[model samples]
Target chain A: MQIYLPIADVSVNWLLLLAMGGGVGFISGLFGVGGGFVMTPLLIFIGIPTAIAVATQAAQIAASSMTGSIGYWRRRAVDMRLGLVLAGGGLIGTVLGVWFFNVMRRLGQLDVIIAIAYVVLFGIIGGLMLFESLRAMWLKRKGIRRPARRSGEHPWYLGLPLKMRFHQSKLYGSVIPLALLALLIAFVGAVLGIGGGFIAVPALIYLFRIPAAVVVGTSLFQILLTMVAATIMHATSNHSVDLVLALLLIVGGVMGAQFGAIAGRNLRGDAFRLLLALLILAVGIRFAGDIVLKPEETFSLVTLDN
Target chain B: MKRSALALLICLASMATATAETLVTSLSTYRVAINSNYTGASLILFGSIERDARTAPRAGPYDLVVTVRGPRRTALVREKEPLGPLWITRGQRRFVDQPVYLAVVSSRAIDDIAAAPMRERLKLGLEAEFASPLPGPNLMGEDFVEAFIRLRRQQGLFQEDPEGVVFLTQNLFRAKIDLPAIAPTGLYEVETILLSDGVPLSRQSTNFEVEKTGFEQATVVLARDHGFIYGLIAAASALVLGWLATVVFRRE
Candidate 1:
């Protein structure tokens, strides 16, 4: 059935929307990823206006992150101090990101920004994951034993000014760098309409050398706050958040996320990483292809409501 | 001079004797309520010519042309240029006060029915209706306008059907205009004209409104006007849904 979306001022098939939500949710659950990278692009492909798609996706991400973080909280996996610091930076970043988003939208350059951002981000993340997983697989095939090493010692940049203690993650680092990293991720999430968990997870693991167990939980916690901030900002400033669209996606997304978490347990780390890397690369390639290939119709028109 | 005066008097007498017929038209409904299931809508525009025997022969039979135009809106039309193997939007033209939707229907081909200048004066064809002001005297502005029209037509927002209007009798006629599912909600101006011998004998104009009703309207108002409450509701519902998902699926 066709449903009218108010903010987007468009009609779309309800079943298609649900399927999109479920598919993206499945990937999110399986990879422990926020799935914004997949969902935002899919929404645009399905004919939702870019502004509404970007703004509305924030609500869905907030929902999914809330569930994920709660689960981690019950298990005592979250580092409250670290999560709070990240959220503090995320709040500031979200404000700036929303401002930038509005500016680009007014100038009619938001679509290009989204396209370029996705291409660059996915290219980097997917390339790294692919190489890392492939190397690990090759090493396993060689049957070479490697010595166990500690993670926190490397990345000497962690010794920068303003050292702060994160007792739960068992790390001493400068709040400045961590805050800056959170700010960057939150800005990306706000502009891209994601939860920023994917970027944050890697940053925590590699940059700060946080324990894997704490990283996921802490990132989820921060993502929840970031998305909430985004939802409010988009609603109040841009009035682009479509509540009905968000609700519909959430219905299928919640159910799919549950099943994804269950299925994720059976997969090995390297294999899972390989699959996720492939998924990211595929989306990145599709976006890049749009830039390289001739568009079917170059001219697009939107009616100004005001 | 005496002969010319006598001829002019004869002509004036004949002109006074001959009269043109007037068209009376009305839409089936003036208001369209768009609900959740409203994919599209079609409106029947039926009209009649108030004809007299002397007027009919003098004015000839009337031909009908109907046009419906949606609210004026500004549009940005962009063209992509290849930038190092990647296509990007390098140039754009802004069109101001352009109709979002336009549908034209006639008894036959517009060109066949009326001369080009006449049609342009009447604003009966797509080109006539979309003759919006350009940004400046740029050479490429015409291309951009054409592109805008082409895209709108492709989306089915702009339509023209030469055979859409049907005449039931010498005096009565009806036409149907289809508004696509993506039709904008606003004031629509519908104009119907009666043409006799390529001259407009009579013209009538009416207006209708397409509005979001029921759940669709409510949500739009909430989002646009009461945005803070709407945002809170959105965040709260997402939180609840998330919590529910975790509780329901925790076992596995």
Candidate 2:
């Protein structure tokens, strides 16, 4: 089961890689969000170089989202126009992200930077999700329905030039803010090796007011495109993608997602979010401990490329 | 003074006669083929002390020192300092053109083999290996070099075994060295020195290469040479796997 990764120049248990992929895939499928965020950290923990872990995780995200977007496409739920605009901005973001990644790597700061990004991102996202889900569950137990929102009051945000209408999502919005948000999401996604599904879905729903039905589909579509671009960029720029690692992860991920989807239907949305929030926070806290705690060995060595 | 000079001359003559012997050695495998299942390689270096019939026999039992030096590379060692809530790499030192992996296996403890000054001059062991010229000294002590050795040793890159070389007979000896799974791929130098009574009589050098073969080699070549295309293929395969998932496990 020991498989050597040519690009990373390391041998790891193939079964462990498969199980990790499967575990991450199950979480993503159960929650309908990306598992990429968790994978990079786990890969690094298991002794894969940070660059390889970050670059290779992008491939797994692309694979997972491909199935999702395709399914959504068949159901005619995806907003192709919006997805294209987001992906266009995503392409630019990915290039810039990869360049920055290269610079940080050369500086020998890639590991610390990645660790910081994961900790901060997971903390904020997980904390918010945990609070929101708990509050909703509490309100439901009290038999108090949330008040309805006033729809027409939020036109100030979408007020930008060059307005376009997305027929599938049934929204009129400026391409600027939406594209800019996609650019931001894609930038962090590429650097952190996440699909940015959770980030995009929330921003789409709250900021752009894109329908829940179309948001998941459109986000997955955009993610699929962006991740594909990210993977290609990482390969050309860093040459850190391990083909053996990627293949094993992809195989296990897809299989796990299938089972996870079936299991997800048995749980309520509130409970699922709470569980996911805990998982996210656990990963965040795990990293925070390493950062704050004194290392057993103060000095570490890395081989530099000629 | 006359008597001392006479004894020194006789000692030189005996040393010259002892140096007539030759050390001949060869590795079990000159080229290590790394495949998918490559964890590590265990290699045996078999050799003998070939002495001429005309020469007097060695006064004492012979000694052997085998040194295996892996490919050379630059390494950056960083020490972390706490900055508020986070620990960040604060100070760093660079070592250029040092062997990434090193293993010294001797018939006896390296210290017992020769005196310190002689060992240092010959560069015979791990201590002498790191004593080579380093870059500009840092504000911090020589702790970085020690730390580097410890780190590499933990990763199985650096090693020392006092009794690794076993002599099968009066003239035949063999040393075993195991290259861990994380061994760097490149030419590795193997050196064997034959010594007796604190005097080195003969030395031999050989080399072997660790190479990734077949699928491993192909992948490295593809990624290095055809980056863009390989990326496309990587991306395409993911998409295919994703599509296949939906097909095989269709949501009702």
Candidate 3:
């Protein structure tokens, strides 16, 4: 069945949309990460306008993050003090990012910017994950164990001024680095329509040395609020959000995540990371090919003031 | 002198009535409503040729050409050029106040109906549309215009059907027009021209409107007019759905 989208001004196949959402959702759950990055690109590939895909996916991200974070919130794993600071930085970054988004769209360069940003980001993250996973496999084969990480050691970021206490995580550090990281993540998230949870979890655990118990919780909490701000900004400033599209995606994602989590339990650590890394690298390479390969038709049309 | 002038006026009046012909046209529906289930719209347009009582029967067969034009819009055609590793849009030409949708239907092939010069002069085909000097800031070459027309045709926004109009009788005719779902909503003007032996005789134009109704209309209005409140509502609704889904799942 085909249904017309109100704000997007297009007709899309309902079953295809549900399947696409479910597929992306399953991958996200299997990897234990937000699927906004994959969802936006897939929507565009299926003929949804790029701006509409970006804006509508923000709402979908907000919903999935809520589902993931609420459990962590109830269990008292999230660091409220630090998460609030991060959300504050995220809110400000969203405004700046939306402004930049509008400017690029008006210049008719928004599509190129989104593609290039994806290529660069996926390349770095995918390459790093592959290297880390392969090294772990080689060390295990050689019967050499990796050194245990000491959470007690404070990184050099602790020496900065304006130190703040995160009592739940048992750490005291400057808010500058945390705020800066949140700003960068939220800004990129706004531009690319990604929740940036994968990027944030690592940054929090390795760079800031936050407790592993609270890392996912804090990242989820911050991302949930940041995406809420993003959805609202996209809806008001750009008028690109389609509520119907978001609803369909959320429904499919909710179901797919359950099945994925059950399947993920059977997979081991290094292999799972390796597969995910390959998937990411493949998507990045596809985007690169789109740019470098000669297109059949170079001429395109655009209605002005869309 | 006054007697001669009166005679000349009477002679001219009688000559006008001897060869006068006019067209009459009507559409099945004047408004096309767009809703959630809307795939596309098909409407029938009926036309007839009327002649003066004193006029003699035409020696040649009558030909009809119907042209449907949608609302005017500003458009741009862009060409990509390779820069390093990426192919980016580098050249652009703008067209202002051009029709967003166009469909031409006729009794026979346009080439068979009229010669090349006449077809272009009458704007009878897609290529003829760009041959005319369109209003724009830049007067680009024919290549850009051709690309623009080709792209629009591929998108189903521009269409041509030579044998679309069928004559029910010598005077009456019917034409079916199909508007694709991708067609922009706006006013559409349909013009029917009568031609005999490649010479245009009479023409008439009628207009209709395409607009979104009910829920779709409300959604678009809210997003465009009351954007702030719409945004807040959208966010709140998503959050509620999220909370509700998790609650339902946990109970199961």
lDDT by residue for model 1 (B29-115), tens: 999999887788999999998866667474355678899999888887888877887777778777777788999999988888888
Better model by DockQ: candidate 1 vs candidate 3: 3
Report the Cα lDDT for residue A36, model 1: 87
Residue B153 CA error for candidate 2 (Å)? 0.7
TM-scores for candidates 1 onward, in order: 0.94, 0.95, 0.96
Model 1, native contacts kept? 0.74
List residue ranges in candidate 3 displaced over 4 A: A151-153, B1-18
Kindly list the interface RMSD, in angstroms, of each predicted candidate in the order they appear: 1.4, 1.0, 1.4
Leading candidate by lDDT: 2
Q: Please name the candidate that would achieve the greatest TM-score relative to the true structure.
A: 3
Superior candidate under TM-score, 1 versus 2: 2
Clash pairs of candidate 3? none
Residue A281 of model 3 has an lDDT of 84
- What local lDDT score does residue A178 receive in model 2, on the 0 to 100 scale? 85
Provide DockQ values for all models, in the order shown.
0.66, 0.74, 0.71
